[model samples]
Target: MNSDKVLDARGLACPMPIVKTKKAINELETGQVLEVHATDKGAKADLAAWSRSGGHELLESAEENDVFKFWIKKG
Candidate 1:
């Protein structure tokens, strides 16, 4: 999905990445996608949980090399 905003959370740890993502998502409109890139291993689970709690949609998640990418759609 084409993202409306890109959040570079690479090298950030747990909670930080998820926190930043939540902030970004809050600024987006419904149906807009936010792309988050992070190196933290906890980002995958943390982001997923955050998305669920916020009623957002996790469109896709993948890892490339050591970086993790999450495509989240704002509700």
Candidate 2:
């Protein structure tokens, strides 16, 4: 998906990725997408839940080469 900004949260631990994602998404206007790259395994579930709770849309997520990528659209 197209993204307005990309945040590299790779190598970060639990909560850190979510924390950074929150900050990054906050910077975007509604409907803009934020792409997050993280190494934390928990980031997938964390980000999904976070996005829903924050009224944002978790557009897509995937893992490749041990990196987890997520696209979130600001609500």
Candidate 3:
């Protein structure tokens, strides 16, 4: 994951988290990985849905210390 880009969205809410993820992904080349971190509870589902709808790959998701981390690979 060293080659992946990380977007820290912790403290952001709702659409902002997903929106930032989308923006970051747009800057990445296809097949590149994006690591997103957010504190919003909605992040898990929102990111998953966004990845699915956009045809991207959700590589991993986990919660730790109230923070959500999403690893996505751009399609």
Clashes of each: 0, 0, 0
The regions of model 1 sitting more than 4 angstroms off are none
RMSD of each: 0.7, 0.6, 1.0
Q: Write the per-residue lDDT of candidate 3 for residues 1-75, one digit (tens) a residue.
A: 443799999999898999899999999999999999999998898899999999999999888999998899999
Quote each prediction's TM-score. Answer: 0.95, 0.97, 0.95
What's the true lDDT of residue 53 in model 2? 91
Reference-based lDDT, residue 31, model 1: 93
**Local distance difference test scores for all models:** 0.92, 0.92, 0.92
Give the per-residue Cα lDDT of candidate 3 at 54: 100
Give lDDT tens digits, candidate 1, residues 1-75.
689999999988888998899889889999999999999998889889888998999999999999999999999
Model 3 ranges with Cα > 4 A deviation: 1-3
Leading candidate by TM-score: 2
User: What would the TM-score be for candidate 3 when compared with the true structure?
Assistant: 0.95
Model 1's alpha-carbon lDDT is 0.92
Pitting candidate 1 against candidate 2, the one with the higher lDDT is 1
Per-residue C-alpha lDDT of model 2 across residues 12-40, encoded as one tens digit per residue: 99989998898888788999999999998
RMSD of 3: 1.0
Error of 2 at 33 (Å): 0.2
